[model samples]
Target: MQVIATAGHVDHGKSSLVTALTGMQPDRWEEERRRGLTIDLGFAWTTLPGGRTVAVVDVPGHERFVGNMLAGVGSVPAALVVVAADDGWSAQTAEHVAVLDALGVRDALLVVTKSDLADPAPVLADVRARLAETSLGDVPGVAASSRTGDGVPAVAAALEELLAGLPAPDTTAPVRLWVDRTFTIRGAGTVVTGTLAAGTVRTGDRLALAGRDVVVRGLQSLGQPVEAARATARVALNLRGVAVEDISRGDALLTPDAFRSTGELDVVLVHPAQRLPAELVVHVGSATVAARVRPLDDATVRLRLGGPLPLRVGDRLLLRDPGTRTVHGADVADVDPPELRRRGAARVRAADLTAGWDADADLARRQVVLRSEFVAMGWPVPSGATEVGRWLLAPGLADELAARVPAVVARYRQLRPLEPGPPTAVLRSALELPDAELVAGLVRPPLALRDGRVVATDSGLPEPVQRAVTGVLARLAVEPFAAPDTEALAAAGLGPRELAAAVRDGQLVRIADGVVLAPGVEDRARRALAAVPQPFTLSQARQAWGTSRRVAVPLAEWLDARGVTERLPDATRRLR
Candidate 1:
């Protein structure tokens, strides 16, 4: 089945023409039938000459209901553009044509209604000429009067030809059903109706609505219950987990996590000659929201939406002045635009967008974005973007981040000279990276991770700490076995923290708490013990090194712990 919308001026017989072709009344409301005018959208369908079915979305032609008209035609691929033979063309007709043209709706059949009341040739010729100026250029024309059923068969034939020419709908795409009507059924809870433009909706399928998931309890198409409905077909869904009041017109039933809802978007004007207003109402699909426009350039503008919509690049939007009949078309260039915070950011951004909406350009601006989010926004992963697990890094972004690492590490070291380079967390923040894995990946030569902290392998201790270490090592050089006492160590500016830094720098060896010796002192002590007998007492070992018990006990214990010496049951130690 295929869906199409009807467009024309008021009293141009748009609804009447639909009825004549479908053999059913398009107007549903009692007031509309009584007043002989369409105030809201009406629906009707019929099978054409073959088994192919066509559904008609009959929109109001009156100027007051232009919003309604826009909603009806937003998702339809083709349109039945109606014009009365007697009226030729009217103000509403022109607006509707502009809307179709702005939306890039190309497949249409121009119908000249009320042929019995006036000559259809002039109106047909005039409507065709006007359509030539828009995207719907030179569509086929048919003169038909719903009153007398004149030329009705030719209208059906023309519609079949139009439907045959339309591109096939993508059934495997993500579902985004724009709700045009919502209400409660007698027994089925909340039921919402819409045109399924892409993907397929099956009964019991879970769909996203307003950030919550709702189950499809039942599904129907063309008043008949169905298990599933594919694209280009109108469907009504019985939903669970939501009340009727919660759902409204213009809300979408979506494939969960398949789309990104964004409030700020950048768009390029479809018709640059039509100047935009500072504020307007934006219509996309069946949704309408007020927006504030900031001009990026004469050809582009930024739209700040009152509410976020599930939007992406290449989506078509209709900008309407709420107080006037002016309507402008725009193509969304960026759904997640950067903030214009700098003095001339707007100008710079305008220049960047001049290349149009390319995936690489967006990736270049964002630097790094989650692959899931990039896909959700309907953006293809650009070639040459670096993939770091779940994230896609812009070209050269990793190198740029890596280049900043040394400076950040230097600043950190300058502030806290006694410590290693910096913690992984610090590097992550300085590089503005989202994950620690990225920080690890950016570590270059001479920069390495030591005990989860980033460090420069070739770096040395701070000058003050180095001076203290040099003083301690110099004293140890003369007295190889004499470890400095607490007071002497403090006098040389060797506190516990500084001593730890010296030990990490391989300048000092810490044997026990507060007992530190020069590097390779353990080997020196082992050789010194070789001069004694195979097994010696602690006092004898103390004599061998000519150091006091305070140095001998810890050093002997350190050797035993390292398996360099063995202790017997009698408390005598012997070098291994």
Candidate 2:
């Protein structure tokens, strides 16, 4: 599927051309049909000769409604720059062309509408010369008359050709549906319609809207129900958990946590007639909001938006002055930018943006940067770059962490030998690292992460705890199944803290509360039980081990828990 928006001056027959080609009315509102002008976005689609479906977004061509026009074509990959042969070129025509060029729209069809009124050859030549200087310089053109239906087939062929040459939409990219229309159906719930710019949205998928999650109750492509909708197609989503009044045009439905909405952006202005005005209307995606511009250099500026917008690096935007009616094209260099707090900071930032990421900077100073963002900014990761999940650490940061973390863990163990080594959270905080994974990555050989705590590979009980454990082990070795009481063990130096440390360090194993045994003591008991018959009673097991019932009961239960022995229904025991 492909979506193409119409651009031209008012009364230039953009809607007429779309209607004639699609055999469906482009205008939906009665007022637009009565006024014979498009006041908002209109939708139409048709099947090409190759049986490929193409959606047409008919936008208002009047300069007054250029905001609405921008909202329509902001995310559409292809466009039809409409120009009437009778009225050659106009101010709105130049404005629309400037927007398309600024947006970096390369796939387009330059159509000369109303060909029956005058010779299209002159108009085509002028339009071609104008486009030659813009981003759509190499785009093809077609002369068509929507009223008489002449050259309409040629227009369809041009659309098919334009789509064929364009690259396929990335269905795996994060979904960012810029809402152009929002309303509610009588039987259904809230419905938001927009061009699926990228990624695939399926029914029942949860989408982020205004910082809240909304499930896609249903999905439609070109007015027909569908299980899922892919990019470059017109999509209408029946949303749940949101009301029609809560959502409006310019609001977006996006993949959760995949994008960040920011009020400040660092951009590279392509062609500014002069220094931008203090305040301008910034248009990107399907949004138009007032912004304050701060010039960084000759071709770069920082725009502070009136509201937050979900944007990314490499997105193209247009800055139009409402007072002077001037437009400037801008390419986003950074979405989450640092604050310019000192004198000459803007100049420093401008240089940094141009030079790209600094390889020598500390990871703590650089913060977390996604690998995808680095690729979008055209900066490859420096050699030996450390990555945690999808984020890349600054160069040399990993080595620095590797050098310091083991020492930190050793110091922590020295202070609290009775407890496990510092937990993952504590390690992250101690190092001032952003994520726990970085701490985990730093834990190497002599240091290991276990049960959410970082501990030395050869971790053992302290001297006092080891002395206590040694006494307990000797006592248990004399009588394997006969465990000492807590009071007796404490008297022998194995107090509560030392006993816990011994267990944690693998010097001892606790079979039950207040009952401790040396490591592998259960195995020795299991071997003695195997010497008995296939099935034996409690008295027989007690006699075989030469221990009383008190020692045999707990040992039997512990062995049962370990699956070393199984108790039968008749009160008999056997090896499992």
Candidate 3:
């Protein structure tokens, strides 16, 4: 299915052309039909010449309802630009064409309406000449009179050809349906209507709406009930868990976790030479919001929205100066922009964005981004980006962080002489990294991870503490299993605090209560036990180590905990 929106001036036979093509009345309000003017949006669909169904969104052409017109055509991919033969291009005609051009709608059919009143050759030539300057350059034109039904067949054929030329919608893309109308049903529930731009919407699918969630109770396409619907089709969703009063026209139904809501954005102006005001009304999809603009350069500006919207990079927005009734377009460069609080920050940022929406530049600017967010923002992972677990980092970021780690560790050790290197969290904070997992990658040679902290290969201990610990280690080396008593340790000036510092320095290993041994005692014990018979009892192990029963019991348990030895049910042990 293909959707096309009507764009033209008031009473230029837009609704009349839609009615003639669809064979259905587009104007729903009686006042609009009575006044012969379209006040709001109207919808109608028809099967074209090739049996391809096309939905037409008839938008109001009056200057007063420009907001409503934007809402109707915001998501539609194609357009039917109507120009009356009797009245050549008017003010609204140029404005509507400017809107279509700003939105980058290229698939269009130029229709010269009311051909019976005057010869449409002059008007068709003039309209085509004006459209050639826009994005929809030199579109197919057909002069049709809805009153006499003359040339209607050719108009339908032109629309069919235009729809055929359009690229196929991506069904696998995330769903973002902009609601153009919301109403209530008596016995069923609340219903919302919109054009499903992409992705498949199925019954029972839960979607996000204005920070809340709602379930799709049912689905309909062109007034027919359907269990599932794909993109480029007009849809009406029966929603559960939300009241009709809670939802407005501009609200969007989104795939959960597929978007990020942001109040500030950086955009590259489509027309950089035009002078803009401080404030403008911004329109994207069906959403319209007031935004304050701060010029970063001639090409880029930052927009602070009145409320948060689910935006992404590469999205196009129409900016309208309400005071002057002028409209232009902008391309979103960054949705989650950095703050510009420092002096000259905005100028530097503008220089960064001056090259225009490059994915590699965006990755370099952010340094690190979650993989889900990078893809969710509608960009493929760039070629040079590095993938670290669930994150995508800028190219060569790991090497840069690794280069800064040794200096950080040296400063930390200098502050506290008796301790080892810094903790992972501290190192992460010092580097200003976003995740602690990144710190592990930054550890290079001469640095080892012990337990959960980073440490150097050699002890970073004080001179006095090193002297005391050396004496204890010399004695333990001769008598490997014979740990000194507390009185003996104190006499050597190695008290509890001093022993703890030695343990952190990797000079001593504290196994159990009143039992502190040399760093490699466990390896020595394993070597001694390996020579004994299989499944030796605790008594036999004590005699083999030539140590007291206290040291034997604790050492055996520590070996069991470290998987160095396995203890049997009968109080026997064997080397694992």
Q: What tens-digit string does per-residue lDDT give for candidate 1 at 1-576?
A: 999999998789888888889988989999999999999999999999876899999999898898898889998999999999988889889889989988999899999999999999998988899998889987999999899999999999999899999999999999999899998989889999999999999999999999999999999999999999999899999999999999898899999999999999999888774366789999999999999989888878999999999987888999998777688889988888888999999989888887665988889888889998988888999888888778999988888888988898889999988888788898988787888767776888788878777889999988887888898889899998899998888888989999888887789999998899998887899899999998999999999998999999999999999998999999998888
Give residue 352's lDDT in candidate 2 (0 to 100): 74
Model 2 residue pairs with clashes? none
Error of 2 at 107 (Å): 2.2
TM-score of 1: 0.76
Q: Which lDDT tens digits does candidate 2 get at residues 147-229?
A: 89999999999888888887899998888899999989988989999999889999999989999999999999998999998
* Deviation from native of the Cα of residue 185 in model 3, angstroms: 2.4
Q: Which consecutive 10 residues in model 3 have the weakest lDDT in total? A: 451-460
Could you tell me every candidate's TM-score relative to the true structure? 0.76, 0.85, 0.85
Candidate 1 vs candidate 3: the TM-score winner is 3
Superposed model 3: Cα runs more than 4 Å off: 338-348, 368-380, 389-392, 414-420, 457-482, 489-509, 517-547, 552-576
RMSD in angstroms, candidate 2? 4.0
Q: Residue 165 error for model 1, in Å?
A: 1.4
State residue 530's C-alpha deviation in candidate 3, in Å.
Answer: 12
Residue runs of model 1 more than 4 Å from their true location after superposition: 273-275, 402-423, 443-576
